[model samples]
Target chain A: MIINHPLLGPRDAQEFTYLGDASLISRPDAQDDNAAEKFHDYLYLRDNPAGLHRELWFHESGDRSWLVVTRNTVTHEITDVQLARDVARKEGRSK
Target chain B: MRYSGFKVIKEALTGHKGWTPQWRDPEPQSHYDFVIIGGGGHGLATAYYLAKEFGESRIAVLEKGWIGGGNVGRNTTIIRSNYLLDGNEPFYEFSLKLWEGLEQDFNYNAMVSQRGILNLVHTDAQRDAARRRGNAMILNGSDAELLDVEGVRKLYPFLNFDNARFPIKGGLLHRRGGTVRHDAVAWGYARGADMRGVDIIQNCEVTGFKIEDGTCLGVETTRGYIGAGKVGVSVAGSSSRVMEKAGMRLPMESHVLQAFVSEGLKPVLPGVITYGAGHFYCSQSDKGGLVFGGDIDGYNSYAQRGNMPVIEDVAEGGISLIPALGRVRLLRAWGGIMDMSMDGSPIIDKTHIDGLYFNGGWCYGGFKATPAAGWCFAHLLKTDTPHDTATAYRFDRFRTGHMIDEKGQGAQPNLH
Candidate 1:
C-alpha cells in the first residue's frame, strides 16, 4: 500500500507504522467525574467503520513525523492526508 | 443417508446416484427461537450444539454469504492447545478435545489429522519461555514436549539450525495438535445442524437489530425482518460493523491476514512448523501443497486483501526457517480479515442489550477455537451465564482490570 503523505508526496506504507484510529488523539480527560468509565471506553472501544476511516500512521522510517491518513477501509484508497500536529490544532488539542 | 462403508459400496454399485445434498437451502423464516449471525464454522457449530446438545429448536444460522465462504475456509488449518495463560490454556485445550471427536460427533469426514505442531525456539530466552509454556500446557491437561536441537533435527533435518542470526536452539511440540480440513469443518457442522432441524439460511445479511426498549427483539436483514427470541453474533472481522447497527462499538479493530498455498509436491512437511523469531507458520495439506501464513497487516481494513510488505515478510520468515521453501512456487494466496481485540483474546458474553449475545475478537486464531467457541456460545445464549471454560471472555474484562493479554502487549490490537 502507498500512502500519499502530505509532506513527502507518495511513500510506501512500510515506511510508516500504523497506530490505528485518529480519534485516539483526543484521549479522554483524566479529571472527569466518570474518568474511569470514560477512559475505558476511550481505550477499548472503537468506531471500526467498514467504509472511509481516518487513522494515524507514524513515519518511523522517514521524517519521524505523524500523519492522519483518511483512507477507505473497503478499498484501501487514500482520500486525504494531513500532519497530525495540524490535525491536533484543528481539533483544539494543540496550541 | 448415513455415510459408511456399506453406503459407499451401495452408492458405487448404483453409479453414485443416491447421494443427496448435505444441507438444505431453506427460505428465511419470520421467526426463530435463536438466530445466529454468520454461517461460518463457529455459527454452524453453535447451532448444531444448541439443537443436538442443548435441546433447543427453531435455531437458524443466518449467513450473508454461503457457509464456509469466510475465515473458516481461509485459515492455515492448524489446531493446537499450547497456550500459556491460565485464562487461555483451558479454553483452547477444551477446543482441542472437542476437535478430537468432532468428525465422529458430526458424522462427517473432516480429515482431522493429528500430525503435530512444532514451534521452534531460536534463543536461550525463547527456550526458557517455551519450557514455561510447555509446563503450563501440561498443567492444563494438554500435551506438550520440549525438544532440544538434536531432537528437532531428528524430526526435520533440513532446518537452518546453524544460521548465524537465528539458530534453532530447541522447540515445543504439541503431539495432539495438527491440521483439519478447513472447509469440511463448516460443511460437517452445517449438515449436522440441518439434520437436527436447525435452519441454515445463507444470503441473508443482517442490516440492523430490532432492539425495543433495550431488548433485542430480532434483526432487520436484507431478506426482511426476522424475529428471534435471542440473537447471537459470531461474524469474525465483520463484528464491529454488525454490532454498530445495534449501536455498539467494539473493543476491536479489523486487519487482514493473508494465507498462501504452494504447488503440490511430494510429502515434504511432516507436520506444522512455526518460526520462533518471526510470525510465520506452515503446514502441508493433504494434497501436498504447503499452506502457510504470517502476521496481519498492521492497520484497520475491511478489505479482504493484504499488501505486499506482509507477504514479503512472511516469505522472508519461511525462507529463514526452511530454506527449501524458497524453491517451492506459490500457487495461490488469499486474505481473511480478523477482529483483533485489545487483549489479543476473544470475547464471548452477553451485551448490554437484553437477548443480544456476542462472540468475536478471535484475532487470527478463531479457527483453532471453533468447537469450544460454539459450545460456550451455545451455553451462554441458553443459560444467560458464561460457560465454565469461558468465564474470562467477558466484555467487562477490559473495564474491570482483567484483560487476558497472552502476548503482554497491552491494548494494542495490531501488535497482539
Candidate 2:
C-alpha cells in the first residue's frame, strides 16, 4: 500500500503508523454530565464499515504528520488524502 | 446413519457404495426457534449443542457462503489454553476439555492431536511471566509445566539458544494443547446438527435485522425474511457490520491476519511452538506442510488479503527462530478477518435488543475456542443467561472498567 503524502509524493505504507478510524479525533468532553457514557462510546465503539473508510495514518518515518486517508476497506483503493490538522481545524467546534 | 467400525467394514466390503452426503442443503424455513447467523465452526457447533445438549430443536445456521469457508478454515489450527488471567484461563480450559471429547461426541474424525504446545521464554522477565501463566493454567484445571533450557532442548534440539539478542532462557509447556482438523470441525458439527433436525442453510446472507420496539424479531436475508424466537450472531470478522443492522456498534476493529504453509516435508515439528520475543508460531499439519503465522497486518481492513511487508516480517521471524525454515519454499499464503477487541478479549453476551445475542471479538484465537464458544453461546441462547465459564465476557465489563485484558494492552485493538 502506498500513501500519497500531500507534501512528500507517494510513500510506502510501511513508513507510516496506523491509528485506526479518523473519528477518534472527535473525543468526548470529559467534564460532561454523561462523560462516562460518552467516553465509553468514544473509546470502545467503532463503525468498522466494509466499504469506504476514513482512517488516520501517521507518516512516522518521513514528515511525522497525520493524514486522514479515505480508502475502500474492501478493495483497498485510496480515493482521497488530506492533512488531519486541516480537517480538524476546518471542523473546529469541540464537544 | 450412525458411523461405526462395523459400518466402515461393511462399506469397505461392499465397495463403499452406500455413502451419503455429510450435511443436507435445506431451504430456509419461515421461522425457527433459534436462528444462528454465520455457518462457521462456532455457529454449527452452537446448533449442534442446542439440539443435543440443550434439548432445543428448530435451529437454523445461516451461512453467506458455504460452511468451512470462513476463519474456521483459514486459521493456523492451533489449540491451547495456556492463559494467565482469571477471566480467560477457565474459559479456554473448558474449550480444551470440550476439544478432548469432540470427535466421539460429534461422530466424526477431527484428528484432535494433543501433541502439546511450547511457549519459548527469552528474557528473564518473560520467563517470570510464563511461570505465572503456567501456574494460572494449572489452577484453572488445565495442565501446565515450566521447562528449563535443557528440558526444552530435549523436546526439540534445533532452537537458537546462543542468539545474543533473543536467547532462549526457559519455556512453558501445555501438555493437552495441540491442533485439530479445522475444516473437518465445521463439517462434523454441521453433520451432527443436521442429523438432529437443524436446518443448515448456505448462500443465505443476513442483510438487516427486523427489529420492533427494541426487540429483534428476525433477520432480513438474501433468501428472505426468516423469523426467529431468538437471534444469535456469531459472525467472526463481520461482527461490527452484522450488529450494525441492529443499530449496535461493537468494541472491535476488523483487521487482516495472514497465515502461510510451506511445501510438504517430513514431520519436523512435533507440536506447536511460539516465540516469546517475536510474533511467530509454527506447527506441522497432518499433510506435512509447515503451517505458521505471525501478527495481524496492524490496520483496519475488511479485505481478506494482506500487504507484503507482513509476509516478509513473518518469514524473517520464522528464519530467525528456526534457520532451517529458510530453505523451505512457501506454497500458499492466505488472510482472514479478525475482530480484534479492546483489551484483547472476546465478548459473548446479550445485546440491549431483546431476543438478540452476540458472540464475537475473538481476536486471533477463536479457532481454539470453537467448542466451548458454541457450548456457552448455545447455553446463553437457550437459558437467556451466560454459561458459567463465560460469565466474565459481558458487554458491561468494558463499561464497568473490568475488561479482561490478558495481554495487558489497554483498549488497543492492534497491539493485542
Candidate 3:
C-alpha cells in the first residue's frame, strides 16, 4: 500500500474514520497539507508517542515547504500532518 | 534661546563635518532565540510581533542589504482592503486595522493617509465584478461604496470623460484604504522591535542553514554559525535560494516590479486610483508627485531595474485617466524583485523540516499586509498551528483541492 513521503514521517498521510468537514484528519493518498484531504476530513488513527508511524505530504501550493505528514503504515492512509515541522522532536531525531 | 539654537546647529554641523562618521556595524550575537532571514518590513515587523506576543525578546532580523533595501522600500506604498478573494480579504482587512493604529503602536509618524482608493471599471464585466466585490465587503463588515459614472466623475472631475479608449466608467470606492510612508514603516518596526530587545542585524547575509538529520538547528551566515531554537524565513525574493539550501524547490517565480514618479505639481489626485482595463494604477504622493506603476518586467530576473515598456504602459494609462498629466515630466523610477507564487497569496506556516518556518510569496499587497502577516506568522511559530485566515494558505492546500486561487488564472501568472 502507499505510504507517507519518505522524508516526512507516516503522519502526513494517515487513514481516519470518516469525520465531517470539521475533522482535521488527512487521507492516505491525497496530497494536501491542510488535512482537508482525509476521507470526509476526519481523524482516523491517533498518534502515540509510544510507536513510530509513516506519513506522506504533498506540497501542492508550490511554496517549496514540505508538509510533515504522519500515517499508519499498515492501513496505508493519512491521519495527521505537521507541515514544515519534523516528526520527532530535536532530541528524538538525534538518537 | 538663540544661542542655544546656534549651539545645537554648530554641534550638528561639527558632527557632520568630522570625517563623515561611519555607521556602526551590528555586533554578531552569540545566539538568538529566533533568527529572521530578511530585514524588510515583514522581517522587522515579525521580530516586533514575536517580542510582543511571545515575550521572547531575544530575536534577530538579519539582512544582506540595509533595512528597507528590498521590496519594503521599493513598493508604491498603496494601502487598501479592496481584495475580492477569500484568502486575501480577512488578512488585508486586519492590516487596514493595524495601519489605522500604527502611529500609536509604533510611536512613529508613518503619514498614513486614508484618503480612500478607487478602482475604475471600464467594462461591463469589470463593473459587475466590482459590484460583487463591494457587496462581499459589506457582508464581511468592511466598508465599500459602489459609485456610478456620475458619482465617479463627481469624485474625480479631472478623469477623461469622453476618451474613446475604455472611457471612464464607475468604480469601486474603498474609503478606508490609502497610502503610508514606506520607509518609515520599515524604520518604525525596526525601532519598535529594537526597543523590545530584538537585534536588527544588517549587512549580515545568511550563507546557509545548519541542518542535520532532516532538522534545522540554526543558520550559517557570513559572520559564522549561530545556534537557534527556531528560524523564520521571511526572505521574500530570495525564498527559492533559501529553501534550496534546505534541499527544497518552491514553485515560485522571481519577477521585477517597477514603480515610477513624475515631476512634483500642485495637489491633483486626492486618492489612489487604478485602471482595471489598462493594468495601471497611481497615487499622487504627499509631495505632489504622481507615484505609479504596473506589472513586472514579465521575466524571471533578480535585477531591480526595469525597461521603458512598463514606464510607457503606466504613463499611457495615467494619461488616459487624466489627459493633463501628459505634459508632466517623469522624475524618478525604480524596481524591486517580487517572489510571485503559483497562487497570489502568501505562505506562512511551518515547513516539513523541524524548527523551520516561512512567510513569503506576498505579491504586490505585502506592504500593507505587513502587520497582519507578522502577527499571524508569530502565532503560527509560537503555537504550531495556523491562524484563522492563514489556515487556507498552507503549503498542502493545493493538492487537496483547497487552493485559494483568488485571481483564478490557475497555475502561474505568466502561464495563466
Candidate 4:
C-alpha cells in the first residue's frame, strides 16, 4: 500500500520508526512539556536497505514544510538536516 | 403510562392495563389528531414524541413497505455530531446526546459506540479546514482536538506515513463520534412506539392525499382512505416521489450511497477514519468486519448497485490510510439512495398545506440525527412552533437566501 513514486524510492520497512500511538492529541496527558513535539507527530521509515554500500543521502521528509534530512540509506546514519528552502537556496537553485 | 427507559414491564395492579380502546371501525375517521407517513426512523420518532408531548394518542404512522426497511437500515452505521455550520451544529449535538442515552431510553442494545472519528488532513489547506472544524466543535460544546502528523503516526501506526499523495499532515479528532447498530435502532423505536399504543400500519403505501380546499384532509393509502387532522412526511429518500403527489416539487436529487465491508480481521482500526482528501472512510464493527463508505454517485439513480470508479477511489483511500487492508478482501458492497437537499441541511417544517408537515432533506446525516429529528418533529407537530435550531431549515430558505450552506458551495446536492 506504500506506493513510492518514480521520483521517490520504494518503501523500505526497516526505515520506519514508531514515535508513539495516534491518540496523544486527544488525551489530557499530552499537555506536559515536549510531549506536544516528541509524541504529538509520528515518524516512520518507508524503507529497509538490503545493500552493503552505505551512502548517507538527504531527502525531503514528505511533510507540508519541506525538510532536508541527511542519513545513511544503508547504514542509516544521521549526518545533516535543515529546511529544504534554507539548504536548497544556499546551493544556488533559487531560480 | 409515563414513558421511561427502554425496558417495558406490564403492570396489572393499578387498573393500568394500558389504554383500553373501543377498537373503532376502520371507517375513514374523517379527522385524526396526527398522521405521520413513512415509517422510517423520523416518522416513528415523530409519533413517539407527539404522544409524549401533547397527550395526543390518535396518531397513525403509515409506511409503504415493512417499517424500517428504507434508508434507516441501509445506511453505513456511523454517528458524529461534530459539524462546522451554524444551523447543523446544534441539531446534530442534540442527536449525539440522544445517541449517548439511546440504550437506556429504548431498552434495546443499539450498540452505540463512542469510538471516535478521525478526519485526516493531507495538506495545509485541509489542515486549516480541520482546525476550523475542531474549533467549531469546541464552540458548540463538543469535544474535538487538532492532531499533527506525529499525532496521527502515534495513534494509527499502520498508515502509510511516507506516501506523498496522502501524507499524514494532521487530522481533526472527534472523540465522541462513532458507529451504531443500524437495524437495532429501527427495531427498538418500532417496538417502543408500538408499546405506546401507536398504530403501525405497514405495507400500506400512501398513493395519494385527500386535499380539502388548501388543507390536507386525509390520506388515500393502497389499503383504504384514512382521515387525519395533521400529517408528517418523514420519508428520507422518497421525499421527491411522495411530495410530487401533493403537486409540489422539491429541489432534490436521488443517488445511491454505498457501503463496503471487508473480511473480518483482528480489528486493526479502533475508530472511524475519514480521508479528508478522498471519499474514503472506515470503522471496525463489533463483528470485526471493516464497515466503510464513500461519496454518492453524481448522477440520479434508484439502482442500489454502484460502479467501479467510487469503489476504486474508496479502496485506494483505504489502502493509503491502512496499508494492511490491501490483504483483506472486500466482502460485499451495497447502496442506499440519499435525499440530498440543495443546501445540505435538513428541512423539518410545515409545508404550504395547512395540516401537512415535512421532515426530509437529511442528506447523509439522516441516521445520526434520527432521534433528535423525531423529538423536534414531534415538538413541531404538537405545538406548531419550530425548534430554535431548525427554524432556518425550511423549504422557503432556498428562495429567501437564508440557506444553511454547510459546504459553503451554495445549494447543490453533491455537498460532500
Candidate 5:
C-alpha cells in the first residue's frame, strides 16, 4: 500500500504505524465535568465505517509526521492525505 | 441427524437423499431471549452452550453473511495453550480441553487434530523466554517440552537450521496443541446450536442498537428491529463499529490479517511450526495444503483483503525458515479482520450498558479460543458473572492497570 504523504511525497504503508480513526484529535475539554467519560470515548470509541474512513497513520520511517489519510476501508483506495496536526488545526482542535 | 459410518453407507446406498441442511436458515423473529450479533464460531458456540449447558432457550445468532465467513474460517487453524501469562494460559488450556472433546460434545466430526505445535527458538534470550513460557504452561496444567537443537532437527529435518542469520537453537513444543478444520468447527457449533433450537439467522445485518436509558433493548437490522432481553456482540473485526451504535467505545483496533495456502503436496509438516525470529506460523492441512500466515497490514481496515507487501514479507519468512517452500506454488491467499485489543488479550464481559454484553478482542487467538470463549461468554450472559477461567478478561482491566498483555507489547495492537 502506497500512502502519498503530504510532505514526503509517496511512501510505503509498511513504514507507517496505524493509530486508527482521525477523530481522536478532537479531544474534549479536560476541565469539563464529564471529562473522564469524554476522554474515555475519545480514546476508545471509533466510527469504523466499512467504506470511506479518515484514519491516523504515523510516518515512523519517514518524516515522523502523523498523516490523516482518508481511505476506503472496503477498497483500500486512498482519496486524500494530510498532516494530522494540520487537519486538527483546521477542525479547530488545538493544544 | 447423527453422522456415522452406517449413516454414510445408507445415504450412499440411497443416492444421498437422507442428508439435510447442517443448519436451518430461519427468518428473524420479532424477539428472542438472547440475541448474538455474529454467527461465527464464537457466537454459535455461545448459543450452543447457552442451550446445552446453561439451559437457556429462545437464542438467535445473527450473521450479516453466511456462517463461518469470518476469521473463524480464515485462520491457520492452530490451537495451542502455550501461553506465558496467567490472564491467558488457563483460559486457552480450557479451550484446548474443550477442543479435545468437541467432536463428541457436538456430535459432529470437527477434525480436531492434536498433532502438536513447535515454537522454534533462534537465540539464547529466545531460549530463556521459551523456557519461561513452557514453565507457565506446565503450571497452568498444560504440557510443554523444551526440545534441543537435535530434537528440533529430528522432527523437522527440512528446516533451514544452519542459516547464519537465524539459526535454530531449540524449540518449545506443546504436544496437545495442533490444528483443526476451521470451517468444520463453525459447522459443528452451528449444527449443535441449531439442534438445541437456537435460530441461526444469516444475511441479517445489524445497522444500529436499541438502547433505552443505558440498557440495550434490541438491535435494528437490515431486515428489521428485533427485540432481545440481552445482546452479545461477538463480531471480531467489527466490534468497534458495532459497539459504536450503542454509544460505547472499545479500546481496540481493527486490522486485516492475511493467510495463505499452498497447493496440495505430500504431507510434509508433521505439526504446526512458528518462527521465533519472525511472525510466520504454518501447518499442513488434512488435504496437504501448507496453510500459513504472518503479521497484519499495520493499518486499520474493515476490508477482508490485504496487500502485496505483507504477502511478500510472509513469503520471505517462510523461505527463511523452510528453504524448500521457495519452490512451492502459492495457491491462494485471503484476509480476516482481527479485533486487536490494546493489551493483546480478549474481553468477555458485560458492557456499561445494562443488558448488553461483549465477547471479542480475540486477536489472532480467536479460532483457538472458540470453545472456551463460547462457554465462558454463555456463562456470563446466563449468570451475569464471568466464568472462573475468564475472570481476568474484564473490560475494566485496561483502566485499572491490569492489562492482560500476553506478549507484553505495551498497548500496540499491531505488535500483539
Candidate 6:
C-alpha cells in the first residue's frame, strides 16, 4: 500500500481512488442559513477515524493529483502525503 | 439442548456429559430493555428478533469480540437475491426468506445451505446486467435462472470455459442462493438470544455513547455504564467508530474486505460462483474449503488485515474463473471491516439520537443481510416503524436524494 505521492514519488496504493474523509475538502457554505443543514452535514457526515486518518486519495493510476493521505486506520501507518490541491490551499480551501 | 439423534446417541453413551455452553455468558446489566451493540450476525440477530419476534423483554447482546467475532466470521459465505434495486430487491428478498427458516427458527444447526448462486455472465454488457439481475430476481419474489452457455457448462464443468479472456457467456442462477455456517450464524444468533432471555455480553468494549440531551441514554462499555432503554447499533466495521461515541457522523467507509480459504480439496465448488469479469466470489466449504472473496482494500481501513494487491487481485479473479484455482493451496486469509455505504445499500435507520438505533451499512453485504438484518432490526427496535422489508433502509437516504444506488456506483464508498 505504498502511497508516498506528493507528486508521485512512491505511488501504488493500488493506483489510488478512495475519496473519504479529508473532511471532504471542507465543503459547506451552500449559501448557509443552515443551508439545508449545512448541505446535510456536508453530504452525510464522516470522521470515521480509528487513529490518524485524513484520507481522500485519487491518483487514479498516477499524476492526476488529489492525494492527502495521513493514514493509520489502526496501523496502516502512512503518516503524511499532501497535494489534495495542496491540502486545499493550506486549509483555507481556496476557490 | 434439543439437538438430537436421540441426543447424539445419548451423548455417545455418556462420556459427553450433557453438553451445553452454547450461550449464556451474561454479566453486563445495569439496565437493558434492549442494548444490542454487535455480537455480529446483526448483533446476534437483533437479540434474536428482540426476544423471539418482538416480545422484547430486557434483552442485551453487547460483545466487542466473541460471538463469531465480526462480519459474522468474515464473509465469502455467499447467499443471494440477485438484486437489481428497488432499494435492494425487497431487502434481499427478505434476507432470502430469512435464509429459509433459519434452522427451523433458530433451533440452531445454522447450516442453512440452499446450495445455489451463479452470476458468471461475461459481457454483452454482462449479459444485459445478468438479464436485469434475473428479472429483478423474478420480480422480487426471488428465484431466478437465466443460465445458458450450456447452462454454465452443466454446473461448472471446470470453468475457464474457453477463456479467450472472460468467455463464459451466461449465468445468473440463484435457486434460493447459498452458503451459511459462517460461525454457525454466530452460534445460531447466540443460541437464539440465549433461549430468549437474551443478554449475551462477552468481552464487551463499546467505549462511549450514553448521551443525554440529544437523547441516547446508554452504552460506554469496556464493562460499565450500561443503561439503555433502547440503544441497538449492530456494529459492522464499527459503524463509523460506533457512531462517533454519539456525536454521530456516518455515511460510512471502513473498507478492508479480504477473505479466502482453500487447502482442503476434492468436492470442487458446485454452488456459488460469481466473477462476471472481476472481483471474484466462490464457495465450496462444507470442509472442502475453496471459500473466497475479492475487491475492497481500495484504501480506508479499520484494518482487519489485507493488502497484497488485494491478494493479487483476488488471485487474478480466481485464476480468471476457475482455471482450477491455480491448483489450490492458499488455506487462509482474513479481513472484514466493510461498513461501506453512501449507497451500496444498508442503513436500517433512526438515529437522531432519541434512544438511538442504527443497524449499519452492510456493504460487501453483511453476511447476506443476516436474517433480514435481524428481522428488520427487530422491526426497528420494536415498532418505531420501518420493517415493510426495511422501507429503503432510511437514515434520511443521503438527505432524501434517496440513494439506494445498488451499484450504480455514485457517492462512491470505494465504488460501492
Return the top candidate by lDDT.
1
- Across residues B234-319, which tens digit of lDDT does each residue of candidate 1 receive? 99999999999999999999999899999999998899999999999999999999999999988999899989899999999999
lDDT of each candidate versus the true structure: 0.94, 0.93, 0.73, 0.72, 0.91, 0.82
Candidate 4 B-chain TM-score: 0.91
Docking class of 1: high
DockQ of each: 0.92, 0.88, 0.02, 0.01, 0.52, 0.29
Pairwise lDDT winner, candidates 4 and 5: 5
Candidate ordering by TM-score (highest first): 1, 2, 5, 3, 4, 6
Q: What is the interface RMSD of each candidate, in Å?
A: 0.6, 0.7, 19.2, 23.0, 2.2, 5.7
lDDT of model 3, residue B334? 92
Question: For residue B57, what is the lDDT in candidate 5?
Answer: 79
CAPRI class assigned to model 6: acceptable
Clashing pairs in 5: none
* DockQ leader: 1
CAPRI rating of model 3: incorrect
Candidate 6, residues A1-95, lDDT tens digits: the string is 78788654886777777878888788877777879988777766677788888878878767677878898988798989978887788878673
**Considering just chain B, what TM-score does every model have?**
0.99, 0.99, 0.93, 0.91, 0.99, 0.36
lDDT of 3 by residue, B34-81 (tens): 888889999888888899877887788889889888998889998888
DockQ of 2: 0.88
* Candidate 2, residue B97: lDDT: 94
| lDDT leaderboard ranking | 1, 2, 5, 6, 3, 4
Tens digits of per-residue lDDT, candidate 6, B1-416, equal 76857888989899898998877776887998778888888888888887888788688888776777778878877777777877778888888888888888787787878899888888788888888878877887888888889988988888887789678888888888888888888888788778878889889889998687888878888888898888888887888887887877888778888888988888867788888889888888888988888888866788799889889989988988887789788989988888887778888878887879998888888888888888888888888888887887888878878888877877778766
Error of 2 at B342 (Å): 1.1
| True lDDT of residue B20, candidate 1 | 99
Q: Return the number of clashes found in candidate 6.
A: 1
Give per-residue CA lDDT, model 4, range B252-291, as digits (tens): 6555688898888886889889877678888898998999
Best by TM-score: 1
* Residue B85 error, candidate 2, Å: 0.9
Off by over 4 Å in 1: none
Evaluated at residue B384, the lDDT of candidate 6 is 82
